[model samples]
Target: DQQVKQNSPSLSVQEGRISILNCDYTNSMFDYFLWYKKYPAEGPTFLISISSIKDKNEDGRFTVFLNKSAKHLSLHIVPSQPGDSAVYFCAAPYNNNDMRFGAGTRLTVKP
Candidate 1:
């Protein structure tokens, strides 16, 4: 069974607008949430992460909000720029070696 899911295959937003990406996980064992961004052929780069102990975490223009009760999490990018367009993946690790990744959501920031 898929532990993590990104229901929307893609999302589009105009420049300078807010872009929200949603993720859902079935595993309650996951205690940490991670977000990664990948450009075409490049490896996914870590964006931000949040611990289950915290409801929200933010870094600059990016923020991750976790709703433990709902088994849901979301990444919000404020004033999204064209350079921010990429495939964003939500991940959770149950242990050091076992990690679950949501099917990425392709974000298109139109200028």
Candidate 2:
């Protein structure tokens, strides 16, 4: 079974607005959450990450929020720019060598 899911396959937002990408997981053992952004021909790059012990983590224009009780996490990008357009994936690590990822959501930021 798929442990993590991104219900929306795509999202669109205007420049300077907020873009929200959501993810849900079924496994309760996951203690770390990570977000990755991928371009068409490049490998996914780590965007942000959060620990289960924290509800929110922010780095400049990007922020990751976690709700352990709901097994949900979201990535928020403020002042969304055209350069930020990419596919976003949410992931959870069950162990050092094992990680589960959500089918990414493609985000489009229009100028």
Candidate 3:
């Protein structure tokens, strides 16, 4: 089964706090990992990615960590702003042609 699960459908945080989103995969063959952020009615934008060969990747306020051995990954947003409120998707592909995605986690940051 090709299921990437985001158990929490949504998360809420106050401004200037750290927001964390978790992801899990059942397939062991997955070799690449990506995190995408989306605003309504638009395609997702790539936030951060980590190859299976690495354990962590970071960009500005965003950070992604992968634990291949445990089949888990997480995205962390530091001092999350209201602008960061959106849906986040975890994606992966074993062959690089098609990527499986989590249902998505919607984050809300209060002002």
Global lDDT scores for all candidate models: 0.97, 0.96, 0.92
Which stretches of model 3 miss by more than 4 angstroms?
none
lDDT of 3 by residue, 6-111 (tens): 9999999999999999999999988888899999999999888888888888889998999988999999999899999999999988575888999999999999
Per residue, candidate 1 scores C-alpha lDDT tens digits across 73-99 of 999999899999999999999789988
Model 2: which residue pairs collide?
A: none
Locate the minimum summed-lDDT window of 10 residues in model 3. Answer: 91-100
Give the C-alpha miss distance for residue 43 in model 3, angstroms.
1.6
Models 1 onward score TM values of 0.98, 0.98, 0.95
Q: Looking at candidate 1, what is the lDDT of residue 88?
A: 99
How many angstroms is residue 63 displaced in model 2 relative to the true structure, after the best TM-score fit?
0.7
Q: Candidate 2 overall Cα lDDT vs. reference?
A: 0.96
